[model samples]
Target: MTPTNILSVEAYFDLICPWCLIGKRHLETALGLLARERPDVTVHVEWRSYPLIPATPPDGIPYRDFYVARLGSPQAVAVRQAQVCHAAREAGLTLALDRIETFPNTLLAHRLVRFVRRQSGAEATAALIDNLFTRYFIRAQNIGDGQVLSDALAECGVDMPGASGTPVRHDLDWLPPLNGPDDLPPRTGLGVPHFVFNGTHSVSGSRPPAALLEAMQRALARAKQIATRTAA
Candidate 1:
Protein backbone atom coordinates (compact mmCIF):
# COMPACT_ATOMS: atom_id res chain seq x y z
CA MET A 1 0.00 0.00 0.00
CA THR A 2 1.09 3.56 -0.64
CA PRO A 3 2.32 5.23 2.55
CA THR A 4 -0.18 7.76 3.85
CA ASN A 5 2.40 9.48 6.05
CA ILE A 6 4.40 12.13 4.17
CA LEU A 7 7.88 13.23 5.28
CA SER A 8 8.93 16.46 3.63
CA VAL A 9 12.67 16.88 3.18
CA GLU A 10 14.13 20.20 2.10
CA ALA A 11 17.80 19.86 1.17
CA TYR A 12 19.77 23.02 0.52
CA PHE A 13 22.63 22.42 -1.91
CA ASP A 14 25.08 23.89 -4.42
CA LEU A 15 26.28 22.01 -7.51
CA ILE A 16 29.86 23.21 -7.11
CA CYS A 17 30.16 21.84 -3.58
CA PRO A 18 31.45 18.27 -3.44
CA TRP A 19 29.86 17.78 -0.03
CA CYS A 20 26.46 18.32 -1.56
CA LEU A 21 27.00 15.45 -3.95
CA ILE A 22 28.25 13.19 -1.19
CA GLY A 23 25.36 14.22 1.01
CA LYS A 24 22.97 13.42 -1.81
CA ARG A 25 24.33 9.90 -2.05
CA HIS A 26 24.04 9.41 1.71
CA LEU A 27 20.51 10.79 1.70
CA GLU A 28 19.49 8.35 -1.03
CA THR A 29 20.90 5.44 0.93
CA ALA A 30 19.07 6.60 4.01
CA LEU A 31 15.83 6.90 2.09
CA GLY A 32 16.15 3.35 0.83
CA LEU A 33 16.63 2.10 4.36
CA LEU A 34 13.75 4.28 5.46
CA ALA A 35 11.47 2.62 2.92
CA ARG A 36 12.29 -0.86 4.28
CA GLU A 37 11.84 0.14 7.93
CA ARG A 38 8.89 2.48 7.65
CA PRO A 39 6.78 1.39 4.72
CA ASP A 40 3.91 3.45 6.14
CA VAL A 41 5.87 6.69 5.56
CA THR A 42 6.60 8.33 2.23
CA VAL A 43 9.57 10.61 1.65
CA HIS A 44 9.48 13.85 -0.33
CA VAL A 45 12.72 15.65 -1.09
CA GLU A 46 12.97 19.21 -2.40
CA TRP A 47 16.40 20.23 -3.61
CA ARG A 48 16.73 23.87 -2.66
CA SER A 49 19.32 26.04 -4.38
CA TYR A 50 22.03 27.63 -2.28
CA PRO A 51 24.85 28.94 -4.40
CA LEU A 52 27.91 29.03 -2.15
CA ILE A 53 29.99 31.48 -4.15
CA PRO A 54 27.73 33.72 -6.18
CA ALA A 55 30.52 36.23 -6.82
CA THR A 56 32.36 33.80 -9.10
CA PRO A 57 32.48 35.06 -12.65
CA PRO A 58 30.17 33.43 -15.17
CA ASP A 59 33.21 32.09 -17.02
CA GLY A 60 34.69 30.95 -13.70
CA ILE A 61 38.36 30.83 -12.67
CA PRO A 62 41.19 28.32 -12.52
CA TYR A 63 40.24 25.61 -10.02
CA ARG A 64 43.70 25.15 -8.52
CA ASP A 65 44.47 28.85 -8.46
CA PHE A 66 41.18 29.71 -6.80
CA TYR A 67 41.84 27.26 -3.98
CA VAL A 68 45.51 28.22 -3.64
CA ALA A 69 44.61 31.89 -3.28
CA ARG A 70 41.86 31.16 -0.80
CA LEU A 71 43.91 28.70 1.23
CA GLY A 72 47.19 30.70 1.10
CA SER A 73 49.20 27.90 -0.59
CA PRO A 74 49.01 24.96 -2.91
CA GLN A 75 49.87 22.67 0.01
CA ALA A 76 46.85 23.90 1.96
CA VAL A 77 44.64 23.35 -1.07
CA ALA A 78 46.02 19.83 -1.42
CA VAL A 79 45.26 19.12 2.21
CA ARG A 80 41.67 20.22 1.78
CA GLN A 81 41.29 18.21 -1.42
CA ALA A 82 42.72 15.15 0.29
CA GLN A 83 40.18 15.46 3.07
CA VAL A 84 37.34 15.73 0.56
CA CYS A 85 38.71 12.83 -1.49
CA HIS A 86 38.72 10.61 1.62
CA ALA A 87 35.10 11.51 2.31
CA ALA A 88 34.26 10.97 -1.36
CA ARG A 89 35.64 7.45 -1.19
CA GLU A 90 33.39 6.77 1.76
CA ALA A 91 30.40 7.85 -0.37
CA GLY A 92 31.58 5.58 -3.25
CA LEU A 93 32.73 8.56 -5.30
CA THR A 94 36.25 9.00 -6.58
CA LEU A 95 36.85 12.72 -7.12
CA ALA A 96 39.54 13.84 -9.50
CA LEU A 97 39.76 17.41 -8.25
CA ASP A 98 43.11 18.00 -9.97
CA ARG A 99 41.62 17.15 -13.37
CA ILE A 100 38.93 19.79 -12.79
CA GLU A 101 40.37 22.87 -14.50
CA THR A 102 37.63 25.38 -13.87
CA PHE A 103 35.62 26.01 -10.72
CA PRO A 104 32.64 27.07 -12.82
CA ASN A 105 29.97 29.37 -11.45
CA THR A 106 26.92 27.25 -10.60
CA LEU A 107 24.28 29.83 -11.50
CA LEU A 108 23.49 28.32 -14.88
CA ALA A 109 23.53 24.78 -13.49
CA HIS A 110 21.24 25.75 -10.63
CA ARG A 111 18.89 27.47 -13.07
CA LEU A 112 18.80 24.35 -15.24
CA VAL A 113 17.95 22.19 -12.21
CA ARG A 114 15.00 24.43 -11.34
CA PHE A 115 13.86 24.44 -14.94
CA VAL A 116 14.09 20.66 -15.27
CA ARG A 117 12.37 20.08 -11.93
CA ARG A 118 9.46 22.29 -12.97
CA GLN A 119 9.09 20.59 -16.37
CA SER A 120 10.05 16.95 -15.71
CA GLY A 121 9.51 16.53 -11.97
CA ALA A 122 11.93 15.21 -9.31
CA GLU A 123 13.26 11.97 -10.82
CA ALA A 124 14.48 13.56 -14.05
CA THR A 125 15.84 16.53 -12.16
CA ALA A 126 17.68 14.13 -9.85
CA ALA A 127 19.27 12.40 -12.83
CA LEU A 128 20.24 15.76 -14.30
CA ILE A 129 21.86 16.70 -10.99
CA ASP A 130 23.96 13.50 -10.98
CA ASN A 131 25.04 14.02 -14.57
CA LEU A 132 26.01 17.64 -13.88
CA PHE A 133 28.06 16.59 -10.87
CA THR A 134 29.81 13.85 -12.85
CA ARG A 135 30.53 16.20 -15.76
CA TYR A 136 32.30 18.67 -13.53
CA PHE A 137 33.85 16.47 -10.83
CA ILE A 138 34.69 13.40 -12.91
CA ARG A 139 34.90 14.48 -16.56
CA ALA A 140 36.48 17.84 -15.77
CA GLN A 141 33.93 19.72 -17.86
CA ASN A 142 33.18 23.37 -17.23
CA ILE A 143 29.52 23.16 -16.19
CA GLY A 144 29.02 26.91 -16.30
CA ASP A 145 29.46 26.66 -20.07
CA GLY A 146 26.15 26.18 -21.85
CA GLN A 147 27.61 23.45 -24.06
CA VAL A 148 28.75 21.35 -21.10
CA LEU A 149 25.47 21.81 -19.27
CA SER A 150 23.56 21.03 -22.47
CA ASP A 151 25.54 17.85 -22.95
CA ALA A 152 24.90 16.76 -19.37
CA LEU A 153 21.19 17.46 -19.67
CA ALA A 154 21.07 15.47 -22.91
CA GLU A 155 22.61 12.47 -21.19
CA CYS A 156 19.69 12.61 -18.75
CA GLY A 157 17.12 13.00 -21.59
CA VAL A 158 16.55 16.68 -20.83
CA ASP A 159 16.84 19.72 -23.08
CA MET A 160 18.71 22.88 -22.28
CA PRO A 161 16.74 25.51 -20.41
CA GLY A 162 15.10 28.20 -22.55
CA ALA A 163 15.36 25.99 -25.67
CA SER A 164 11.61 26.37 -26.25
CA GLY A 165 11.82 30.20 -26.19
CA THR A 166 10.89 30.37 -22.54
CA PRO A 167 13.47 32.60 -20.89
CA VAL A 168 15.78 30.90 -18.40
CA ARG A 169 16.05 33.13 -15.37
CA HIS A 170 19.57 32.90 -13.89
CA ASP A 171 18.75 34.88 -10.79
CA LEU A 172 17.53 33.01 -7.67
CA ASP A 173 15.47 35.92 -6.41
CA TRP A 174 12.23 34.03 -6.87
CA LEU A 175 13.15 31.73 -3.96
CA PRO A 176 12.35 34.31 -1.33
CA PRO A 177 12.09 31.77 1.47
CA LEU A 178 15.81 32.20 2.07
CA ASN A 179 16.29 34.56 4.99
CA GLY A 180 19.06 37.20 5.28
CA PRO A 181 21.22 38.74 2.56
CA ASP A 182 23.48 35.70 2.22
CA ASP A 183 22.88 32.47 0.31
CA LEU A 184 22.49 30.48 3.55
CA PRO A 185 18.98 29.08 4.00
CA PRO A 186 17.55 29.90 7.42
CA ARG A 187 16.80 26.23 8.16
CA THR A 188 20.38 25.14 7.52
CA GLY A 189 21.97 27.77 9.76
CA LEU A 190 25.12 27.32 7.64
CA GLY A 191 26.52 25.44 4.59
CA VAL A 192 25.18 23.36 1.72
CA PRO A 193 23.97 19.72 1.80
CA HIS A 194 21.81 20.71 4.77
CA PHE A 195 18.63 18.75 5.40
CA VAL A 196 15.41 19.89 7.10
CA PHE A 197 12.76 17.26 7.83
CA ASN A 198 9.08 18.22 7.96
CA GLY A 199 10.18 21.91 8.07
CA THR A 200 11.18 21.41 11.69
CA HIS A 201 13.95 18.88 12.37
CA SER A 202 17.19 19.92 10.69
CA VAL A 203 20.53 18.16 10.27
CA SER A 204 23.60 19.81 8.74
CA GLY A 205 26.66 18.37 6.95
CA SER A 206 27.24 15.16 5.01
CA ARG A 207 26.25 12.90 7.86
CA PRO A 208 26.32 9.10 7.67
CA PRO A 209 23.23 7.20 6.53
CA ALA A 210 22.49 5.98 10.04
CA ALA A 211 22.43 9.51 11.45
CA LEU A 212 20.09 10.60 8.68
CA LEU A 213 17.85 7.59 9.32
CA GLU A 214 17.60 8.48 13.00
CA ALA A 215 16.63 12.04 12.15
CA MET A 216 13.99 10.82 9.73
CA GLN A 217 12.53 8.48 12.34
CA ARG A 218 12.42 11.28 14.92
CA ALA A 219 10.75 13.66 12.50
CA LEU A 220 8.16 11.02 11.65
CA ALA A 221 7.38 10.37 15.30
CA ARG A 222 7.08 14.08 16.07
CA ALA A 223 4.78 14.67 13.11
CA LYS A 224 2.64 11.68 14.09
CA GLN A 225 2.23 13.09 17.57
CA ILE A 226 1.21 16.46 16.19
CA ALA A 227 -1.34 14.90 13.84
CA THR A 228 -2.80 12.78 16.66
CA ARG A 229 -3.23 15.84 18.90
CA THR A 230 -4.90 17.86 16.16
CA ALA A 231 -7.28 15.01 15.37
CA ALA A 232 -8.32 14.75 19.00
Candidate 2:
Protein backbone atom coordinates (compact mmCIF):
# COMPACT_ATOMS: atom_id res chain seq x y z
CA MET A 1 0.00 0.00 0.00
CA THR A 2 1.06 3.61 -0.53
CA PRO A 3 2.17 5.71 2.43
CA THR A 4 -1.17 7.48 2.73
CA ASN A 5 -3.05 4.24 2.27
CA ILE A 6 -1.76 2.68 5.47
CA LEU A 7 -2.06 3.54 9.16
CA SER A 8 0.04 1.85 11.81
CA VAL A 9 -1.00 1.41 15.44
CA GLU A 10 1.16 0.01 18.18
CA ALA A 11 -0.56 -1.21 21.35
CA TYR A 12 1.24 -2.03 24.60
CA PHE A 13 -0.85 -4.21 26.91
CA ASP A 14 -0.82 -6.94 29.54
CA LEU A 15 -3.20 -9.91 29.77
CA ILE A 16 -3.82 -9.78 33.54
CA CYS A 17 -4.91 -6.15 33.45
CA PRO A 18 -8.68 -5.55 33.36
CA TRP A 19 -8.14 -2.07 31.96
CA CYS A 20 -6.12 -3.53 29.08
CA LEU A 21 -8.99 -5.80 28.15
CA ILE A 22 -11.36 -2.85 28.20
CA GLY A 23 -8.85 -0.85 26.19
CA LYS A 24 -8.64 -3.64 23.62
CA ARG A 25 -12.39 -3.49 23.16
CA HIS A 26 -12.31 0.27 22.77
CA LEU A 27 -9.45 0.02 20.25
CA GLU A 28 -11.38 -2.56 18.24
CA THR A 29 -14.39 -0.27 18.20
CA ALA A 30 -12.24 2.62 17.02
CA LEU A 31 -10.79 0.44 14.24
CA GLY A 32 -14.26 -0.53 13.14
CA LEU A 33 -15.21 3.12 12.98
CA LEU A 34 -12.12 3.83 10.89
CA ALA A 35 -13.00 0.97 8.57
CA ARG A 36 -16.46 2.36 7.94
CA GLU A 37 -15.43 5.99 7.56
CA ARG A 38 -11.98 5.67 6.04
CA PRO A 39 -12.08 2.64 3.78
CA ASP A 40 -9.13 3.98 1.85
CA VAL A 41 -6.90 3.53 4.89
CA THR A 42 -5.53 0.10 5.65
CA VAL A 43 -4.68 -0.11 9.37
CA HIS A 44 -1.97 -2.38 10.67
CA VAL A 45 -1.83 -2.96 14.43
CA GLU A 46 1.27 -4.23 16.22
CA TRP A 47 0.74 -5.67 19.71
CA ARG A 48 3.61 -5.22 22.15
CA SER A 49 3.63 -7.18 25.39
CA TYR A 50 3.78 -5.21 28.64
CA PRO A 51 3.58 -7.49 31.64
CA LEU A 52 1.97 -5.60 34.54
CA ILE A 53 3.11 -8.04 37.22
CA PRO A 54 6.21 -9.78 36.02
CA ALA A 55 7.40 -10.76 39.49
CA THR A 56 4.48 -13.02 40.49
CA PRO A 57 5.31 -16.70 40.74
CA PRO A 58 4.61 -18.89 37.73
CA ASP A 59 2.20 -20.93 39.85
CA GLY A 60 0.51 -17.64 40.77
CA ILE A 61 -0.89 -15.95 43.87
CA PRO A 62 -4.43 -15.88 45.23
CA TYR A 63 -6.20 -13.23 43.14
CA ARG A 64 -8.24 -11.64 45.90
CA ASP A 65 -5.43 -11.53 48.41
CA PHE A 66 -3.01 -10.07 45.89
CA TYR A 67 -5.35 -7.23 45.02
CA VAL A 68 -6.33 -6.66 48.64
CA ALA A 69 -2.70 -6.25 49.55
CA ARG A 70 -2.01 -4.07 46.52
CA LEU A 71 -4.95 -1.79 47.30
CA GLY A 72 -4.25 -1.85 51.06
CA SER A 73 -7.84 -2.83 52.04
CA PRO A 74 -10.82 -4.87 50.93
CA GLN A 75 -12.95 -1.75 50.75
CA ALA A 76 -10.42 -0.05 48.51
CA VAL A 77 -10.30 -3.08 46.28
CA ALA A 78 -14.08 -3.12 46.08
CA VAL A 79 -14.20 0.54 45.06
CA ARG A 80 -11.60 -0.07 42.36
CA GLN A 81 -13.52 -3.10 41.14
CA ALA A 82 -16.72 -1.09 40.92
CA GLN A 83 -14.96 1.56 38.88
CA VAL A 84 -13.43 -1.04 36.52
CA CYS A 85 -16.79 -2.81 36.19
CA HIS A 86 -18.51 0.42 35.21
CA ALA A 87 -15.88 1.15 32.58
CA ALA A 88 -16.04 -2.44 31.32
CA ARG A 89 -19.81 -2.27 30.98
CA GLU A 90 -19.49 0.95 29.00
CA ALA A 91 -17.13 -0.88 26.64
CA GLY A 92 -19.55 -3.83 26.26
CA LEU A 93 -17.45 -6.16 28.41
CA THR A 94 -18.23 -8.00 31.65
CA LEU A 95 -15.56 -8.06 34.35
CA ALA A 96 -15.77 -11.39 36.17
CA LEU A 97 -13.25 -10.45 38.83
CA ASP A 98 -14.88 -12.82 41.30
CA ARG A 99 -14.25 -15.72 38.95
CA ILE A 100 -10.50 -15.19 38.98
CA GLU A 101 -8.61 -17.32 41.50
CA THR A 102 -4.91 -16.81 40.73
CA PHE A 103 -2.90 -13.78 39.74
CA PRO A 104 -0.35 -15.25 37.37
CA ASN A 105 3.05 -13.97 36.28
CA THR A 106 2.59 -13.00 32.62
CA LEU A 107 6.14 -13.65 31.41
CA LEU A 108 5.13 -16.89 29.75
CA ALA A 109 1.94 -15.38 28.45
CA HIS A 110 3.89 -12.59 26.72
CA ARG A 111 6.41 -15.08 25.37
CA LEU A 112 3.55 -17.03 23.87
CA VAL A 113 2.43 -13.89 22.03
CA ARG A 114 5.90 -13.32 20.62
CA PHE A 115 6.09 -16.94 19.55
CA VAL A 116 2.76 -16.69 17.75
CA ARG A 117 3.73 -13.45 16.06
CA ARG A 118 7.00 -14.93 14.82
CA GLN A 119 5.38 -18.14 13.63
CA SER A 120 2.00 -17.18 12.22
CA GLY A 121 1.82 -13.37 11.87
CA ALA A 122 0.46 -10.24 13.52
CA GLU A 123 -3.18 -11.21 12.82
CA ALA A 124 -2.86 -14.55 14.57
CA THR A 125 -0.93 -12.93 17.38
CA ALA A 126 -3.75 -10.43 17.87
CA ALA A 127 -6.27 -13.28 17.97
CA LEU A 128 -4.19 -15.08 20.57
CA ILE A 129 -4.01 -11.90 22.65
CA ASP A 130 -7.80 -11.48 22.57
CA ASN A 131 -8.25 -15.12 23.53
CA LEU A 132 -5.76 -14.79 26.38
CA PHE A 133 -7.46 -11.68 27.78
CA THR A 134 -10.83 -13.45 27.64
CA ARG A 135 -9.41 -16.53 29.30
CA TYR A 136 -7.71 -14.56 32.06
CA PHE A 137 -10.30 -11.89 32.84
CA ILE A 138 -13.63 -13.39 31.76
CA ARG A 139 -13.00 -17.13 32.02
CA ALA A 140 -10.64 -16.60 34.95
CA GLN A 141 -8.28 -19.32 33.79
CA ASN A 142 -4.65 -19.58 34.89
CA ILE A 143 -2.97 -18.11 31.82
CA GLY A 144 0.50 -18.73 33.14
CA ASP A 145 0.04 -22.49 33.01
CA GLY A 146 2.01 -24.23 30.29
CA GLN A 147 -0.92 -26.40 29.30
CA VAL A 148 -3.24 -23.42 29.22
CA LEU A 149 -0.87 -21.42 27.03
CA SER A 150 -0.40 -24.43 24.76
CA ASP A 151 -4.13 -24.85 24.45
CA ALA A 152 -4.58 -21.14 23.72
CA LEU A 153 -2.05 -21.40 20.91
CA ALA A 154 -3.85 -24.41 19.49
CA GLU A 155 -7.15 -22.50 19.55
CA CYS A 156 -5.51 -19.83 17.45
CA GLY A 157 -4.34 -22.47 14.93
CA VAL A 158 -0.74 -22.26 16.13
CA ASP A 159 1.45 -25.21 16.93
CA MET A 160 2.72 -25.76 20.47
CA PRO A 161 6.48 -25.62 20.47
CA GLY A 162 8.20 -28.68 21.92
CA ALA A 163 10.07 -26.44 24.36
CA SER A 164 6.81 -25.33 25.94
CA GLY A 165 7.96 -26.74 29.26
CA THR A 166 10.84 -24.27 29.27
CA PRO A 167 10.06 -20.67 30.08
CA VAL A 168 10.82 -18.25 27.23
CA ARG A 169 12.73 -15.17 28.27
CA HIS A 170 11.95 -11.89 26.54
CA ASP A 171 14.09 -8.78 26.12
CA LEU A 172 12.00 -5.64 26.51
CA ASP A 173 14.93 -3.25 26.43
CA TRP A 174 13.96 -2.21 22.88
CA LEU A 175 10.73 -0.51 23.93
CA PRO A 176 10.80 3.20 23.11
CA PRO A 177 10.66 5.74 25.90
CA LEU A 178 7.10 7.06 26.22
CA ASN A 179 6.75 10.72 25.31
CA GLY A 180 3.36 12.39 25.69
CA PRO A 181 2.06 15.61 24.05
CA ASP A 182 4.51 18.46 23.35
CA ASP A 183 3.42 20.57 26.31
CA LEU A 184 3.69 17.58 28.64
CA PRO A 185 6.99 16.01 29.70
CA PRO A 186 7.74 12.38 28.91
CA ARG A 187 6.24 9.92 31.38
CA THR A 188 8.81 7.83 33.23
CA GLY A 189 6.26 5.26 34.32
CA LEU A 190 4.67 2.77 31.92
CA GLY A 191 0.94 2.17 31.70
CA VAL A 192 -1.15 -0.61 30.23
CA PRO A 193 -3.29 -0.18 27.09
CA HIS A 194 -0.87 2.45 25.86
CA PHE A 195 -1.18 3.24 22.13
CA VAL A 196 1.30 4.61 19.58
CA PHE A 197 -0.22 5.77 16.31
CA ASN A 198 2.12 5.48 13.31
CA GLY A 199 4.96 5.77 15.83
CA THR A 200 4.48 9.53 15.77
CA HIS A 201 1.67 10.12 18.27
CA SER A 202 0.58 8.20 21.35
CA VAL A 203 -2.34 7.97 23.75
CA SER A 204 -2.27 6.36 27.20
CA GLY A 205 -4.72 4.43 29.35
CA SER A 206 -8.10 2.93 28.48
CA ARG A 207 -9.38 6.00 26.73
CA PRO A 208 -12.78 6.05 25.01
CA PRO A 209 -13.16 5.04 21.35
CA ALA A 210 -13.70 8.64 20.28
CA ALA A 211 -10.40 9.69 21.81
CA LEU A 212 -8.53 6.82 20.19
CA LEU A 213 -10.14 7.54 16.84
CA GLU A 214 -8.98 11.15 17.09
CA ALA A 215 -5.45 9.99 17.86
CA MET A 216 -5.47 7.76 14.79
CA GLN A 217 -6.70 10.60 12.62
CA ARG A 218 -4.10 12.95 13.97
CA ALA A 219 -1.35 10.43 13.34
CA LEU A 220 -2.52 9.69 9.82
CA ALA A 221 -2.73 13.38 9.01
CA ARG A 222 0.69 14.06 10.44
CA ALA A 223 2.17 11.23 8.42
CA LYS A 224 0.60 12.51 5.23
CA GLN A 225 1.85 16.01 5.89
CA ILE A 226 5.38 14.74 6.40
CA ALA A 227 5.16 12.60 3.30
CA THR A 228 3.96 15.56 1.24
CA ARG A 229 6.79 17.76 2.47
CA THR A 230 9.29 15.05 1.68
CA ALA A 231 7.82 14.55 -1.81
CA ALA A 232 8.03 18.33 -2.44
Could you estimate the TM-score for every candidate?
A: 0.87, 0.87
Q: Which residue pairs in candidate 1 collide?
A: none
lDDT of 2 by residue, 138-205 (tens): 88899988778877877888755343675432333222332223212234357878999988889899
Tens-digit lDDT track of model 1 for 55-128: 89989999998999999998999999999999999999999898999988888788778767777888898888
Worst 10 residues of 1 by lDDT: 174-183
Specify the poorest-scoring 10-residue window by lDDT in model 2: 175-184
**What TM-score would you give candidate 2 relative to the actual structure?**
0.87
Compared with the true structure, model 1 gives a TM-score of: 0.87
- Position 110, candidate 1: lDDT: 80
Off by over 4 Å in 1: 1-4, 160-184, 187-189
